[model samples]
Target chain A: MPSLFFTRLRQGQRTLPFPDAGPDLPERFRGLPIIDQSLCPSGCDACVEACPTDAIASDDSLAIDLGRCLFCSECSNACPQGAIQFSRQYQLAASRRADLVLKTGQSLQLAHRLADDLHRILGRSLKLRQVSAGGCNGCEADINVLNTVVFDLGRFGIQFVASPRHADGLLVTGPVTRNMSLALEKTYAAVPHPKIVIAVGACAIAGGPFREHPEVLNGAGAILAVDLFIPGCPPHPITILDGLLRLIGKIASPAAAHGEAP
Target chain B: MTISLPSFHNGEPISLASVPLLSIREFREEIIAAAGAGATLTALFGTPAESGRVRLFSVLGDPVAGGLAALSAEVDDAYPCLTVECPQAHWFEREIAEQWRIEPQGHPWLKPIRFQAPYRPPGRTWARLPGVTDFFAVRGPEVHEVAVGPVHAGIIEPGHFRFQCHGERVFHLEISLGYQHRGIEPALVGGPGKRTIHMIETLSGDTSIGHATAYCEAMEGLGGVAVPARAQALRAVALELERLANHTGDLAALAGDVGYLPTAAYCGRIRGDFLNLTAAICGSRFGRGMVRPGGVLFDVDPRLAADLTRRLDNALKDLEDAGRLMWDAPSVQARFQDTGAITAETCAALGLVGPAARACGVERDIRQDFPSGFFRFAQIPISRWSTGDVFARAWVRWLEIQRSGVFVREQLASLPHGAIQTPVGAPRPDHLVVVLTEGWRGAIAHVAITDPNGRFARYKVIDPSFRNWIGLAIAMREQQISDFPLCNKSFNLSYCGHDL
Candidate 1:
């Protein structure tokens, strides 16, 4: 017991002081993409052809939808003119799906806080029921890390409950498959009234890589009205925390936090 | 008469015509005889042949000889099952029957393995829901049944477990999966296009490097591309890092299951530290987009390599401390030592791979048996424990963690200098290739058969989970029902990996 105590003492406080300050993200970490239309050569669609998922739309102006983007940077690598670039900005959550789309030279906007009523109802604490519906366990594993000592998502009073009855909202992962659609719906219904659904990862938001497969229902949006969308192949734990904190009105919008715009 | 099966080396492409086509009777006889003579059946699947017939392929691995044999037989919808003689062929036979809609005549306990439609031309479907199959039931006054999951309490993939128990003691446990199946194999049939590598990386998301390496090796084999020694060393480093992270996480999860908090807390952080090292190398923590066909996408520069080595050393030190704390704890040892014990005989019979087999003293590691890529140059000693219990599994993981740490450090310090990426040509037409990668869990095998156009005609992936899930179920026999989580974590099999 004494040795165990000493070990714990050596480990020290492991949680990140996030929302107060951002994580020290790696330089190579792919996040919000920047598109430069000026750099794109005439009659070039290399990035469009290279994108596994059709996250890039190059008909007129270059635009990327974070909802479908896997952050693989294949498009960036494929572009000869260097038209597309992925920045290390990790805060890519959005309240509305349309907000996830970034046009040429546009930066990713932070997710909007919940309505005043929601803040009154769930501002202090949020209980989430995570349902992994056909997820490849990547998203599930990252979400699990939220509770670990490093991320310590519980410090924010956001807890993942075992039962849907106890949850205030449903945190759905995976590319909701046919076999899990029924269970996902049942889980959503089990959550009480005024329940919010937050879709985590590329799979939960837009089916990510398995997008057009016949077996998957695409994502959580096909079944439920998602209140917030967090994007990544599997969003990093910090990304998830940022999204959750923003949704619960725990953090200000990136624009407001920077004291620039509404 | 002794049957001669066409042999091929791992990561080498062979013409499909070279694999001898046997009659159904001969195929069954040969496979059964091979099993009797101590060969492990690696993979068995069927592809559509001419005139509504199916070409069934069987892969057998001989650990002693360090060789792999492949043979095929054409069957017209019905064939004699080999499971009657070879118990290891049970699940593989069921999978063939389910996917091809072929009837393995007179096979016992035949059922759908993935509960999906056939990929063949006719597409005769099985009209039943997933997890709604006939379960082996035990009935008596004291005997009761317990069904768990498809939706588990914790964060996990979906699978159904039905245990027949008598007063808290489990008699038999049947695991029914397929809830996580997304038809990934069918998605990979056409070509090695843009999405193929991404699909392979997520074949089992936790095993990103393992499956990705296997898929790349298969592609490179067909393309006849030799990966540079530097790229091979980089891949080995990433693969070992993946193993280290997962094994550390599993050890922590096992401690968590038994309520040993110190090891659980520290190891979780240590596991994340290892993942961060991978991320430092290739952006993503899971090593996504790091491994590409012909070579890896990212290169570990000298500075990053040094950083990785330093972090790895620190993490290894911390992991050793936590592991010592847990192993020395009497409570943890008491919970893990005898619970969920599977004998070496049972492990070999089930053809279990990875740590589960090694824990049973089976000595079956793909890295050793069929050396490919970096393994051919540098071999890490196989770590094995004889107990075949939860403790043995955890102990094996600790030993592996130490070895993998040493390997990663050594490779990082001496990283060969060269270009990381090489251009790969089109796959050879009408060829069959099998690539085996020892994933963190076990052996991940990918078999790709190309058409006349050099497109993938049939791609088969056999995750180690497919072979080890049964081992978990069998291990639960005569154990306490509540120890299920501990046993399940000790094995730590992948659901989607198995389902696909």
Candidate 2:
């Protein structure tokens, strides 16, 4: 018992104070992609060609889809003109599907707060059920990490319940494979009415890398109404937490509606 | 007498014509003979052949001799079952039957492994619904059956498990999976297209570094691309870090299953700490977008490398404390001691790999037995235990965690300096290569065959989960039904990797 106490003392206050002041991310971490269309060489489609998931547009404007993006740094690496760079902002979630698309000038459309009636019922204490239809476990791991002592998602009154019937919403991951399509439908149906849905990761949002495969139905959006879209190959845990916080009104919505105040 | 076949090393590309195409009887005889002599059946898959016939290919690994052997046979509609003589081929035969619309005549359990359309058109489809099939049952008034998942209660991937029980004791456990198939192998048939690496990276997300390394090695073998020393070193570092993270997480999970909260809570965070070290090297926590065909994409500067070593040391310090608490607790020990014991003989008979097999003292590790890439230069000794229970599994992981931590620190301390990547060209036509990596779970094998035009003719991935899930089932025999969660976590096999 003495040793246990000593060990606990050594561990000492590990949780981070986040949403107030963010932690320091690694310089190499690729969170959000910033596209400078003016620097694009004439008739050059290097970024588009280099994108494995075709997240970049072929048009002259160089629009990129954050939902489809794996955030692989392939675009940044392939661009000789240095038109594309990945910023260190891990807050990339949105309310609508089209809001995830980043054009050259516009800022990302962040997720809006829940409806007033629903917010009154669930804003303080929200319970969710996670369904991994075709996930590679990347998104699932990060979601699971939120329950750890460091993230301590329970502290925010957000918990992942065991039963869909007990949940206020469903957080779905993966590309929604054909084999799992039925089960996913049944799971979403089991949740209580007025339930919200959040699509996590590139696979759940826009099918990620397995988009055109015949076996996959692209993503969760094909069959369900997603209230929020969290984008990444598997979005970082903070990104997911940020999305959930914004959706439930735990974090205040930002003032800027578009590009970083020109 | 032993059978003679064309043999090669890990990641070595050999001509398709070199593997002797024997008759079905000869192929069966060769595999049985090899199994009797203690060679492991590493991979068994089927490719399309002429006149609507399916060509069955087998890769056997001689762990003792450090060599891999290959042979093939063409079968029309059905072939004699090899599972009766060699139980390891049971799952492989079922997979072949489902994928090629061929039957393994007289096999004990013939069911659709993955309920999906066959690779070739005009082939009849099996039961298309996943987990909608007859399960083996035990009948009596007192006997009851328990069914769980496809949608489990926890935040996890989908798969169904049925336990036939009499009161508290479980008679049998049947695991039905394939709810996560994305047709990854079939999608790779055209070329090494843009989406290939991404698919390989997610083949099983936890083993991203492991699978990515195997695919890259196979591609390099086919294209004859020479990866620089620095790139190979970095790949090894990432692979070991993956091992450290997963092993720690698994240890945490095992503790949680027994209702031990302290170790569970601490090790859970430490697992993330190891993942953060991986993120420090590249960007993603899971090591995605780091490995490529010819070499790695990210380079570790000296300062970053030093920082990683320091942080890794700090995490290891915390892990040691958590591990000690778990081991010292009597309640944890009582639950884990002899709950799910499988014999070493059963392990070899089933061809189990990774820490599950190592827990049985089998010494079947890809790195030690089939050293490729950086493993050829530096080595981590295989950690094993003899009891083959949940305790042994957890103990083996702890031993591995310490060893792998040491390996990462050493690699980071003296990283070889060179270019991170080199250009790799198109693959050679009519060539076949088999690559194996010792992933955190177990041995991961990828077999790639190129066509006349240098396009992928057949690409087969055999995840260790394919072989180990049955091990988890067998370990639960006669154990308390409630111990299912503990046993399942101890093995922690991948459903998507197996389904793919």
Candidate 3:
């Protein structure tokens, strides 16, 4: 009887740390897009299109928005440069939409400049909301992972408010598959005035790979007012963290990722 | 990949029998005839021709004909409809109907599961595709449609399940998917590269090894490449760990679903323990580090291997004690018994695999019948039973767990030392290599294309859920509404895995 009691005691003690540490969150646990920009091949846009979320962007160079990425890692795997990765930092969960917006890696200079430009244009504090255009769920999956225990993004003083009506910015993921226009339009229209749109993944920038689909209507920037552009297939979590940091001036410049030519 | 001439696949001319469907009207008839014959092929899913025509595929088990093979008929919208007689085919047919506009003519329950009504040219939105006839119009009394997802309240993947009937007893259910269709089929058609494994590994997070192992086997089979014996032993070890981890977690989940918190908590805690062990050897915990195209990517750490065996032996004893408590408790047994009962007939008709079908008395496991990788070695054992119910599922998974321990021991003792993987420079072009793995769930198949140099051309991954989701819809019939969590848990179909 004493031994059984001890066994039970041992079992209970083990579970003590419980969910405070968060979920098992598994390996390749697709959290958010974190780009090691140093590894990216500049002109290749496979990840941009691979993201069901338009969480990737590359008008000139690639950038990412933590707020919109799905963390599908389609880009990381598809990337010839091995520039993207899925980080284990899932607990960026937040209630507000904009609190999650983060730019990652050496690309922060562009993001900082873009954020300054947005602040100048708005002349006030800003908030952003994200909508997916024909992206695969990679970006969305990561974005959702952020809402879990580890990242608890709400602590970052940002929130992922569902509606765009009260937003200062808009984030987009995916290549704008033909089927998503109405939902995108509805989401876009729901946002209030003085909004700046940030295209997140590769798809929104140039329609990514699914560009010539007979059904798709590409170019998210064409649909709204543009601000900053972040690119990745599905960037990594740190990239997302970096992207948000860049927006709020927490980080001076976009950081370089691990294992790069630098 | 060798293309054998169309000999006789279940006594039918395989590829030559199909004709290009000209319109949607004719296609409806086909569904009607097949449905009447008790043919309930869930998804008419396959690759579309680059020339812009769709291949209409259906899985059938004809008593007169015999066996299950995906019967493909490439056609335009004018193919026949199978949904007319098969009322359960509303969602899949609708997806096919909207994506290709190949309507199932006589579908009794024509409803907009995904695509919105009043079809649009490019008006097809994400959740709302172009269009399918609205299903909400036919509402049963006392029960209203509760549209659950595409975006869920939990961290689970997106799948829209519509319940039909009054509040208490569910008369019927319709599951709508295709939300995360990342164009995996199209991506597979290009050169083979890392994407194949990436896509396969992520096919279902839990089913990773199953898919990857099967994929490596298929590619090797096609290329006729011999794997190093040491790598084979390591693959066996990895597979056992994966099975052990998945089964332990699943048993706990099943317990939790029935509201047994202790069992739930116990199993959940150990779930990651095995994954951590896997990481101790491989860089990634998902076992993604090894098992490449030709062979495994790396060797296991000998020290790590020794540690794993000890850890596993200890876990086995703890698990056994827990199982005793679970089986003896009346409340737990009450919660489990007949909660999710799938008949043997239903399983055979649907062709469900793994524990889901095994529990129902369907004695089919790819490891034994469709052998690959380390499975051919006489060292490992295959555990099975033919119950075909939730209890049966639990039984099979438990047996597998026990068997897993034995396999791990064998693997460690017989650990071979040698080079792990051969160099894969580039792929041979213009050939089709089909790879299949017996994932914890069941058969995981990967279709890879290599160009002349051995780099990827195109790769298609078909996880068991692609076939098993059909069993879920059928199994739910006559089950009480409250038991859905139990029923769904028994099958545990990976929504993200299938959506991709």
* Candidate 1: residue pairs that collide: none
Model 3 lDDT, residue B415, Cα = 80
Tens digit of per-residue lDDT, candidate 2, span B352-383: 99999999999989999998989999999999
- Judging by lDDT, tell me the better candidate of 2 and 3: 2
Model 2 chain A worst lDDT window (10 residues): A253-262
How many clashing residue pairs appear in each of the predictions shown? 0, 1, 132
Tell me the lDDT of candidate 3: 0.57
CA shift of A84, model 1, Å: 0.9
TM-score against native, each model: 0.98, 0.99, 0.66
lDDT, candidate 1, at B420? 85
Q: Per-residue alpha-carbon lDDT of model 3 for A1-262, expressed as tens digits?
A: 3544544665655422222333443343455446765666767788787755455787765766544453445577678777777666543322223433444443122355344554465433445566665554445444543443334455555455655675666667665544555556766787776566666544565454444444355547556655555554344333454456456654444343433321
Candidate 1 chain B: 10-residue stretch with minimal lDDT: B119-128
Candidate 1, residue A133: the lDDT equals 87
Candidate 3 stretches greater than 4 Å from native: A1-7, A15-262, B1-76, B81-133, B136-141, B378-387, B424-430, B448-459
Model 2 CAPRI rating = high
TM-score of chain A of each: 0.95, 0.97, 0.53
